[model samples]
Target: MMTIERLREEINKIDEEILSLLNSRASCARQIGELKQKNSLVTYHPAREKEIYRQLLATNHGPLSYDTICAIYTEIISACRGIESPLKIAYLGPEATFTHMAARRKFGSSVEFVPVASIADVFAEVEKKRADYGVVPIENSTEGVITHTLDMFIESNLTICAEILLEISQCLLSNSSLEEIRLVYSHSHAFAQVRGWLKSNLPTTKCIEVSSTAEASRRAAMEQDSAAVGSELAAQVYHLNIMAKGIEDRVDNYTRFLIIGHSMVGRSENDKTSIMFSVKDRVGALHSMLSPFNKHNVNLTKIESRPSKDTIWEYIFFIDMNGHIEDDNVKEAIDELRESCLYLKVLGSYPVAG
Candidate 1:
């Protein structure tokens, strides 16, 4: 057995080695960034990132899980981001919003954050090249799909580069006593999600809708008799008291966020592909579109429809499936799907989290 003194000396040496290697890596990344800038190449290369993580995980040995390895590399990449330019990420916000939280969780606080008033604006910022990426809520386990985000996917040219799943916990925030509160405020979705809880706890309080949960928290902070049903982050940011905690109607509530950018990335061993398509207005059109997946043995995870903004009664179907677009089976399925649908677009194929 090694002595404690010897172990301490070994650990110090390891720490010094890690610091030296990281410094060298950062210098090399800076040089690469300069070359990319000279070639006018964009900094957010999702495909390259996926490839790097895939190779890293493949070579990983015992003592660390795949997620731990990926997380360490994520920070390495984030630190190298400044070698090009501080990545500007757009999110639906006034700051302290869940979207903002997701963005920070994914990219870290080093990247510059641009909070927009609406989801549409977040997409627009990415499309217009004002931001490197946009983070937006795609779906919630309790409340179903966020239709606006799905519609934007159908309408925009953005690709889903990465995804983040956030476990949601909401609280009732106020400045006054629970009995003194006569009104509650929250975004419509948040209210809908916690309707059951509200009925049980504050049945008599009048519910008011606001632009965003952050706004609701702001209103709650300003009005003594009003409370906001929002994330705990909101309460902390707005300096409000938590009247009640864990107030969500369901404990398993989680929201999935999508990172949207300009291009599709290469696939990983574990990946999920998203596509938007419109079936012909004929019998079996939808079935024919999906038949390819069955034939190819591709797993279809989700399918949702939205009204096609261009025409009345026409609809666009969004699909999420296991496997990356580069897989032979996935590519074949897309080819067959294209033949069946009037229109089809592969939104993106990105690595699924471990």
Candidate 2:
């Protein structure tokens, strides 16, 4: 039988081997980066990242969970990518918000994160080349869509390079005890999600609406007898105690965020395409616009409508479809779709979030 001392020695040897391999990988990444820069190619590739994850996960027969392996590789990949090219990512701001969390999850901690005040600012950062990419919330499972984010896409020329699905776990953070808490601060959407829990736990506490959960945490940290409903990260950033955790009323709450950049992502094994269009002024035009996808056997994952803002009562339709724009079925479907629409735009084709 192996002794404890021997097992530790073996583990240390394996750790050294890992360190050596990581350094080799970093060297290779730097070479690739140089080639990409010489060729004028983008540093980040969503399809390649997805391919790496897929290949690793497929071969994994592990003592650790898939999530654990992915988390470990995420940091390693981030570090290697940083050695190649240091990236600056813009996100909806005052860090510790859900958008910030989503941005971190997508790009990892190696990148510089710039937190802007609004979704439009995130777009501006990327559009002006101040940031390499931008992350913004596009929709929520419980709250439908972020109309402002959708609206920004109509005017901005940025493409959706990737999507991130973040499970939202709201927490109550404060310096005071539950009994001593007299006020609560949170975003309006957050308050709506945890309404039932707050009603039962702190009925008399007045809930003040703020721009974001991080801001709420900041306010709670400064004010006496006040608590904030936010993320665990916010609690750490603001130095507040987690008075209550998993406080959201629903268990399945999730928010989807989009990574916007100038570079268009190439097709992956599993790809999704997003498009925006406006139907012509004719009865059955909207219905006719969707018929092509069914006719071409193309799958549409989601469809949403927002006011054209160009014309009153005229709506612009956004659709998320199942394949890359390069695919035959998708190409055919869009070709047919344009006949019924006054305007159409292919936002991007990217790897679907796992």
Candidate with maximal lDDT: 2
How far in Å is the alpha carbon of 311 misplaced in model 1?
Answer: 3.5
Off by over 4 Å in 2: none
Q: What is the lDDT of residue 334 in candidate 1?
A: 95
Query: Compared to the true structure, candidate 2 yields what TM-score?
Result: 0.99
Model 1: residues >4 Å from true position, as ranges? 1-22, 38-41, 45-76
Q: RMSD of candidate 2 to the true fold? A: 0.8
lDDT against true structure, model 1: 0.87
Local accuracy of candidate 2 as per-residue lDDT tens digits, 227-247: 999999999999999988899
RMSD, each candidate, Å? Answer: 3.4, 0.8
Q: Candidate 2: worst 10 consecutive residues by lDDT?
A: 279-288
**Candidate 2 clashing pairs?**
none
Candidate 1 least-lDDT 10 residues: 41-50
lDDT of 2 at 250: 92
In angstroms, the error of model 2 at 243 is: 1.2
| Residue 180 alpha-carbon offset, candidate 2, angstroms | 0.7
| Model 2: per-residue Cα lDDT at residue 225 | 96
